[model samples]
Target: MRTALTIAGSDSGGGAGIQADLKSFASVGVHGTSAITCVTAQNTRSVDSIFPIPVAEIRKQLRAVLGDFDVRAAKTGMLFSAEIVRTVAKELRGTSFPLVVDPVMVATVGARLEQDDFADALGDHLLGLAALATPNRFEAERLSGIRIDDVESMEAAARAILRLGPKAVLVKGGHTKGVLVDVLYDGRRMRRLRGRRYPKTLHGAGCTLAASTAAYLALGRPLLAAVESARRKVAAGFRQSYRAGHGVEIIDSHAVPD
Candidate 1:
């Protein structure tokens, strides 16, 4: 069986991070492995606290998995510090496997996930190494220094991020007022993935999408196809979403495929 890896934080709530990534990978029929970078005391309402795992330990986990498993593709989320980001990038430097980098800067409950120096570290080391970089509206804005109020700005932000050296960038527009449109720009062309706006607020949608993309890539799908499949999976996940806590609903990573 094909395998994919998620190098991310562990969400104690099981709504996002490594937990969500593994579930999403399973939903798409890929065996999932993980290298956790941090652990969080969190739930649907808020992130209570976070403890970043040591960089050396994180590298050890990566080495263990890469040495033993035929991991075809990998995605990263919530590398809480500059050191962690640099370490992950260094580990993945020469691997030919597809890498999806989810620049997870903030949580759904508005908690900051990365340190002040994280942006520089990620740009200098990680983004260029990624096959694809998935960042939400706020994250895109933070990375590109462009306000994304509409599709035009989204495009601008995507182009700006593309300049940072990723082969492609997906700027998620779920936070927009009306329809949801995610912009995908590979160095040459751009595609807009349009989806309906669901009434419920859901957590883990980003992690699910990125993880599913990695799963598809592991399955040997091309870059664009992997992204499209992942988008559909996330939409299905949203339709199957359920309230896991009083604060907000969580997307069902195991949503039946359509």
Candidate 2:
């Protein structure tokens, strides 16, 4: 079996972040490994406190995993500050690997998780280096500077983000109303992936999508194939979403496909 790595923060809530990523990877038949960037004292309701790991430790965990594991692909989520983003970019240099940058910024509990400059750094230094970028509506708006209010707006946002250099951009419309219609753009063409609107906003949906894409990439799918498979997996996860926390239904990573 192929192996994948998730470089992200840890959610003590077990609803998102590294926990969700690893579960999704396993569901897709990939061995999952992780290097945590932040640890939050959180539960189903809200985050109590956040403790960020040192940059040196984060780098060490990444290198140690890379040295020992033949990671077929890697996904990054929730690198919460400018320094960590720069550090992660520096560490990924010269590695011919498929990278998925989730560009996580906001928490479900209304706390901001990324620095104000992270989107700029991501566009300038990190995105071009990624095989793909998976940003939902709010994150897409932050990344592309194009506010997405509808399906047509999602297409425009994906195109704008593609200009930042990821070979493919999957702009998730999971945040929109009427339907969950995700848009994919590659500068030359566009594809719309639509699904029924699940009634709830599950925690960690973004992390699950990004990590599932990594799993598909690790399994040797091409970029578009990876995006497609990730979308299907997330949709099924939504259908199987459960009430784990207080506010929204949390995605059952057990919804992971085999």
Candidate 3:
């Protein structure tokens, strides 16, 4: 079986982070491997606490996974600190496989997930090596210094982020009003993808999309096709979403294609 790796934190809630990534990978029929960068005590309602794994231990996990698995593609979710981001960037620097960087800044429950310097570290060391970087409206604003009020500014944000060195940038429109529009831009052209407007935001939806994209990439799909496929998978998951707690609903990672 083809294999993919998720370099992210472990969520005890099983709704996001490494748990969600692994589930998304398996849902798409890829063998999912992971290197946990931190552990969070979180649930549907909130993230109560987080414990960062030592950089040395995180490095060991990455080495162990890369040494054993013919990891076809990889995606990073939550590197909670600048140090962790730098370490992860360094570890994947020269790998041949495609990498997806999910610039996770805050949790679904409004908890801050990154250190103050985390964004700088990611922009400097990691994004340049990414096949694609998936950032939501808020994340795009933070990364590009452009407020995305509409599709035009959204494209501008994608362009600004593309300049950060990723092969491509996907600026998600989930946080915007009306129909969901995600813009994908490489240096050449821009492709705007429109999706259904779900009533509420699902937890881990971003992680699932990024992970599914990596799964498709691992399965040898090209960039745009992989992203489109991943978005479809996420929408399907959302249609079948359910609440595990009283807080927010999570995507049905279990309700996946065989």
* Candidate 3 stretches greater than 4 Å from native: none
lDDT of 2 by residue, 61-98 (tens): 99999899998999999998888888888888878989
Worst 10 residues of 3 by lDDT: 249-258
The per-prediction CA RMSD against the true structure, in angstroms, equals 0.8, 1.4, 1.0
lDDT of 1 by residue, 84-144 (tens): 9999999998998999999999998899999999998898999999999999999999999
The TM-score measured for candidate 2 stands at 0.95
Model 2 scores a C-alpha lDDT of 0.87
Cα lDDT, all candidates: 0.93, 0.87, 0.93
> TM per model?
0.98, 0.95, 0.98
The candidate with the higher lDDT, 1 or 2, is 1
Task: Predict model 3's lDDT versus the native.
Answer: 0.93
Q: Which stretches of candidate 2 lie over 4 Å from their true place?
A: none
Query: How far is 99's C-alpha from truth in model 2 (Å)?
Result: 0.7
The residue ranges of model 1 lying beyond 4 angstroms of the native Cα positions read none
How much is 149 displaced in model 2, in angstroms? 1.5
Per-residue lDDT value at 35 in model 1: 99
Candidate 2: pairs in clash: none
Worst 10 residues of 2 by lDDT: 249-258
